[model samples]
Target: MRMGKGKTKLMAAGMSLTVFAGLLAGCSGSNKEESSSSPKTSAASPSASGSSAASEQPSKIDTSKKVDLQFYMLGDAPKDLPLIQEEINKMALEDLNATVTFNFTTWTDWSQKYKLLLSSGQPIDLIFTADWTDYQSYAKKGAFLPLDELLPQAAPKLYEFVPKDMWDAVKIDQKIYTVPATWKEYVTEGIAYREDLRKKYNLPKPESIETLEQYLDGIRKNEPDLLPLADNQGYHTESIRQLTTKTVNSSNKVPYGLNIMYDAPRDVTSYWGSPQHLADLKMYKRWADKGYWPKNVLNIKDSGHDVFASGKAAALLGSENPNRFNDSVIKIKSLHPDWELGYFPYPNAKGFAQPVHPIHNGFAIPRSSKNPERALAFYEKLVTDKRYNWLTQYGIEGKNFEVEDGKYYKMIGDAQSNGFPREGMQGWAWRNPEFMLFEKSFDAVLQMFSDFDKIAKPDIFQGFPEDWTPYQAEKAAVEQVEKQYLYPLNVGLIDDVEGGLKLFMEKAKQAGLDKIQEEYKKQWIKYLDDSGIQ
Candidate 1:
C-alpha cells in the first residue's frame, strides 16, 4: 500500500501537515459543554448513577424508526458515490433502518478543511480518522466519544469483529475513542519504475538504491524529456531519510520531529540534526542538479503517477499501499500499455523500521453524533456483511465491478475509468478481512509483500501510541520552524546543504526542539518500562 501526503500520516521528517486547531464539540460555543459530556440519548450518555448500563444494553437498539446519519470523510466525493450510497442505504433500511449522508474534505486543503468541519460542530455521526489524520490529538482534545461501553452493547458484532489486541491499540489514557480498522495490510516505501523503459533502453531492473541511480542515470542520458523521478514538494522525504539512515538506529515510533535511535533505543534526539539528514540533502542536491526530478518539482502539483501517466516521468518514489497496486499501476497500464511497471522496496537489503498498521486509517464516532449507537450498528454491517462490504468498497457489484470464478474482482465500465473515491465507501477505514476481494493484478502486489517479508524488521514499539498532550505546544512550534526550511532543503532548492541545515538546526532549537525531545524521551522511558522493552 502506498502512503502519500493525503493517505499517510504526514511525518515531520520534512513532511508534516500544518497544525490546525481542532473543533471539539464543547468548544463550539453553542454546544461547548455538551461536547465534553455524552448526549442524553447517546449510547454513552452520562447518568447520575455513574453506570454505563444504559449504553451497554443491546436491547436499547431502536430499529423501528428510520434515522439518517451524516458521515464525514477525507478525500473527494466521487461521481458515482451517490449511486453506491443509495444501494447501501437500501440495505441499511432493511437491517438497521438507517441511512447515511456522506460529506467530504477535498484534497486541495484537506488538513485545514478537516479541522474546520470538525470544529464547525456539524452533527456528524461518524468520521474517518487515523493516526496520520490527528486521531490521537483529537482524542486528547475530546473531539470523539469514548466507545468502550457503547461498542459492546449496540454494535456487539463489531465489538467481536475487531480483535482485543487491536482494540487495545486505539486506547488513549485507558479509554477507547476510535475503532481501528482491521485490514490485512502490508506497506513499505518503494520505487515504482517503468519496466518497459528500462528493458527498451537496455537497463537493469531497479533492485537497490544504487541500481535505481544507474537507471535514472540512463534515463538522464537517453530520455531527455522524461524525468527519472518526479516529486511534489517534499514527496515522502521520510522514506528517503530512512533509506539514507538504514545504517543509523532510529525509533519505530511514528516520527514527530524527534525520537529514539536504534542504537540508543531509550534516548531521544532531533533527526533533522542527525548526520543522515545532511547526507540525504547533499545526495538530493546532486540528483536535482543532474535533472533526475523536474527543475520546478516544488511547484508541480501533479503526483509522480500523473506525471508518469502523462509520459513526463519515468518513476515514482513513495510508500506503496499494496491495496492500491491495481488501481494505481493497472490503470496506468491501460493508458500506456507498452510500459511495464516494477517496484523496488526501500532498505531493500533487509528489514523495515516498522510495519504499516491498519490503524493508520479507521473510523470514529464524534462526540457531536446524535446517534452513536445507530452509527456503530450501521458500521458493523459494513464490515461484517458481504453484501454491504461489496457495496461499500466496490459499489453495485455488476455495475462497479465483476468477478470471474477463478479470477479476482475487477472494476468495469465507468467505475474502472473513474476510481471509486476514498470517500465513496470509507473502504480503507473498515475491517476488510472477508470484505477484501482480490484483484487479478494482486499476484504482483502479493509477490512484493512476500519479497518484503524476507527483510521486514519488526518494530517493538509498533502499538505504543505516544500521548502528545505534554509536548503538543513545543512540537507544534518546532514543526512550524522545521517546515519552513525542510521543504526547500528536501527538494534541493537550497544553495548550501550545510549552511541550510545549520540554520534549520538553530531555528528548531529556538522553537523548543530540545524541550520536545526531553518530553518524548521521558514518555518513551515510561513506555519501555510499561511494555517491558528491555
Candidate 2:
C-alpha cells in the first residue's frame, strides 16, 4: 500500500507476518511457460528449463547437501507463522534438501535493522525488496547478488514465468538484482466513507473536494462521537494532494515536499508555495476550525483506517490498492455490518490514474547469501506452484481460507482473528496475479480495479533509477525541515496559512531545497531524454 510515507510506516507496523513452509514434493513438472492470462495448476517441481524451447534440458545443478536458509521480511510475525513455517520447511526439505528460517524486522525499527542487515553482511538468503525500500540504491551498492545467470539455472520455471519487461525494469547497471512481482496494481489514493451515515444524514456523494466537504459537514453536524475525517500526520497532506493537484510524484527518490503538475512533468517546485496548496491550506484550516478531525490528529499515532474501523471516524483516506482497501472493508463489515461503506477513488476527480510501477514489490538475494540457489529454488515454488502459493499466501487452505471454483477466496472460522489474515505475510514480493484468488465479497473493489485498468496510464517516470548518493547531506537536511515545518502545516495546526507557507519555504531553502531541486531536475530531464520522451 502506497499510503504516502506516514501511513505506509503505520501500516507496516500493523502488518503481521505468517511463515509458510512447503516443499515442492515431485521432480516432474511441466516446463511450459504458464499463460499470463490464465490460472494453472501447480508446477510443484523444480526443473532445469528456462523456456519451452529448453524443456528437454536435463538437471545439472546439485542439491545433495542439506542447508538451512534464512529469509527476512518486514512486519511482526503472526502467531500462526510458525505453524505455516513448519509446513513449508517440511516441503522445502523434502524437495530441495533445505529448510527456511523466517525472520522479521518488526516495523518499529525495521529501517535501521534492514540497513544493518545489508551493511553488516548478514547471511540472509532471501529478503523482501521494493522500490519504496531503496532497492535500486542498494543494488547499485552491491548489497544484492546479480541474478541474470542464476535464474535460468536455479529457478527455471520462475525465469520463464515472469515477463521480459518486468525483468528489464528491475535491472540496475544492466544486471538483474531482484525478481519483481508479476502483479499489476493501481495504488492511487482514495476515500472510504460510511455510506450508512451519508444516507442517514442525506449528504451529497463525495465525488470532488466540494462534495466531500458537504459530506464531512453533514457527519460533523450529525455525529458528535465520530470524527468527520480520520487523519494522521502522514495522510493529511496526501489527502489534500489527492483532492487538489491530483498529480503523481516526479520521483520517489526526492522529498515529496516538491510538486510536479500532471500536465507539466518536467517542472518540479516546492508545493508549499503553490497557489493550489495555499487554497488547500485555507480549506484545511476551515475544516480544522470546524473540528473535522481531532485537534491533536497529528499526534494521534493510531492509523486512520483503524480509527475508521473502530467507529470513531466517519471516513478513511488511503491507497486504493485492491488488497488493502478490500481487507479494510472486510474487517470493518465484519465488525459493524450496519455501517455500509462507499469508496471514491481520488483519481475520479481528475479522470485518470496511474498503475503501480512493476518494481513496486519484489525479492532479492543478499550478497552475503550462503544459499542463493536454494533461496531462488524455494521462491520459484512459491510463485509458480498453486499449492505453495495458497499455503504461503492464504495460509493452510481449508483451515484458514476456502476457495470457490478455484478463483474466489474467503476466510473461514477465526482465521483473521487468529492473526492469519489472507495475504498478510508480505506476499506482494511474489504475488502472481495468474494464481491470485479474488475475495468473494469484494464486488465494489473489483469494479474499482476494472475501472482503474481502463483509465490507468503508464507512469512517465517509471523505472527511473534515482541515485541520491551525491546529495546525501542535502537530502537529510531537507527531510528534517519537512518534519519540523511541513508536517505542522499539513494538518492545519498553524493558524496563518500564508505565514506558515512562507516560513516552511524559508526553512526548506536554508536546508538546501534549491540544491536538491537542481539535481532532481537534472536527473529527471536526463531520464526523459534517455527514454526519448518529448
Candidate 3:
C-alpha cells in the first residue's frame, strides 16, 4: 500500500546509464566509523553451522556501548548536508546511542569513485549499494561481508518485513551481502504524448506500436513546428530495444553479443542480429524517412523529454515507472497548465514490461567494518521507526517539512524544489514509502502498479548474479566495436542498412562475438535447467 507513495519520476538520460539505473537502483551510502556493534558476548555470536538461531534469540542492542558509524552515499555532498547531518546525529544519539558521518562521490565520475571506494577497503561501516553499483562484484570479491548471520540480530524487523524472495535476490551463492530497499515499480518503455496535441489533431490513442505510428504520422502531417517523436542521445533506440527483444536475464551489464529471445529456448543469442533488432532498425529508419524524427538524431545532445517539455515535440520515447511521474513532465505541466501529459505503458502489443527488481537500493556493511551490529541496528530503525525514517528521508520536520492531514508537505522556499527537500539527499536507502509524502501523480502511480501487475511478466532469469570476469577482454573489445559500428546503424545515421549490418557483424565477429555468444548460451542453459524452466 505504501509502495508508490512519494516516488520521484526517473529520467532515461544516457542510454546505458538509464537502463542500468532502472535495473540496479542502489548506489553508495558514505562516512568512516569503527565497527563497534557486533556482539562480543557468546550469547549473541553466530553459530559455526551458520544457522539463524540468532534470529530466534532476543536481538537487543547493547545500550551500554556507544558507537560512531560512517556512511557513504552516491551523490555529491549537498550544500545543506551538514545541517541535515546534525539532525541525523541528534536522532542517532537519542535512539541508537551512536553518531554518524556521511560522505559522497560526486556525479562527475561516480562509477570509478564507487569502484575505488570498495576496492580500496576503507574503514566504512555502511555504504550505499545496489545491483547497478556493482554490489554483486564487490560482494563476490570479498569487499562486502556476508550479512545472513547479522540480519536477524541487527535488523530483525527488516529481516521479517522484507519478503523471502527479495532476500533471495540479494544473495550470491546463498549468502546475502546487502539489504534491499523495498519499492514497487515496473521498468518498461512507454510513449508519452502531449494530450492537448492529440485532442487538437484528433489523433488515435497511443496504445500500441501501430497506433503510435498513426499518432506520429498525424503529427508529422499537421504539426509543422513539432517533431512527431524526439531523440536525445539515442534514447528511442534503447526504448525500442526493450519493446522488441526479451532481455536475457543475465544481460543487464553487457552491451552487446548476447542473443536472448523472450519466447523461450531461453538460450543466449546475438541481440544485434536478432530479428527483433532488425525489425526495430527498419521501423526507425522508416520513421526517419517520414521525418518523424530529426535526420541527425544521433548527434542531438539535448535531453529528449526536455525538448518535449518545451512543446517542441509531440511525442517522446523513454523508460516509464508506474509508481512515479517523469520530473520533466511534472515541471512542464506545472508551467503549461493547458498541456497535459498522457502515457501509453507499452509500445509493442506484448505489453511485457520488466518488473521492478526488488533490490533497487539499500545499505550494506563492508568487510572492513568493525561494528556492523550497530550499523544495521541503526538502519533497522531508519526504516521501521516513523520519526527516524522521516528525518533520514525528508530531514528536520519543522525546518524541511510539515505534516498536514497525515501527509507530508514541504515548506515553501528553497526546500520546495521538485517535490523534494533541498536540505537532504532524497531518500536513497531503506526507503519506506509508508512514511512518504504523496506527489501530484500519487493516484496515477498507484494505478500503474495495478496495471502493470496484470500485464508484466517476472523476468525468468532474475536471480542469476552475472559474473563478467571470464569475458572481460571480449566485453571490452565488443563495447568498442558497438561504439564504432552499431551506434550509427541503430540510430539511422547510416545510409545503407544492409551494408552497415554486414560491417557491424564483421567487426563483432573480430571482437569475439561468437565466443561471447557461446559463453552466454552455456551459462543461460545451465541457469534454465537449474531453474526447471524447460
> TM-score of every model?
0.81, 0.84, 0.75
Of 1 and 2, the candidate ahead on lDDT is: 2
Looking at model 2, residue 191 earns an lDDT score of 80
Residues 473-493 of candidate 3: C-alpha lDDT, one tens digit per residue: 887788788878887776677
- Model 2 per-residue lDDT tens digits across residues 1-534: 223553343223212110000001112122111212222232222323222222333223578999999999987676679889999889888878999988988765477689899999879999998776888878887899999999999988788766666677678899999998765556676788889989998999887778888999899889887788887774656665766564654123234466765555566677757787788778778888888887787788666766776667888766434556677777776677766888877777766766566567889999999988888988887887666776788888777777766556777754347456777686887765545665655555555656765655456554667777777788878878887887777777899889998998898889888888788778877875665444
State how far residue 39 of model 2 sits from its true place (Å). Answer: 11
Most lDDT-accurate candidate: 2
Q: Assess the local accuracy of residue 134 in candidate 3 as a C-alpha lDDT between 0 and 100.
A: 63
Higher-lDDT candidate of 2 and 3: 2
The full ranking of all candidates by TM-score, starting with the best, is: 2, 1, 3
Off by over 4 Å in 2: 1-61, 108-113, 250-256, 414-416
The best candidate in terms of TM-score: 2
Candidate 1 lDDT by residue in tens digits, 1-534? 123531222122111111100121111211111222222211121134322111233424878888999988776667788887888888888878899987877655577788876788878899988766778778878889999998877787677656665676667778888887654345545677788889889997766668778999998898897778867776747656544444222222246556454334455566666786788788888888888886677777665555654556787776344444445566675566667777666546435534444356788998789999999988877765667776777667666667645335666643336546322454677744433455556656555554554444434344455677787778778778766887788888888999999998898888887777777678777866665444
| Decoy 3 TM-score against native | 0.75
List per-prediction Cα lDDT, in the order shown.
Answer: 0.63, 0.70, 0.62
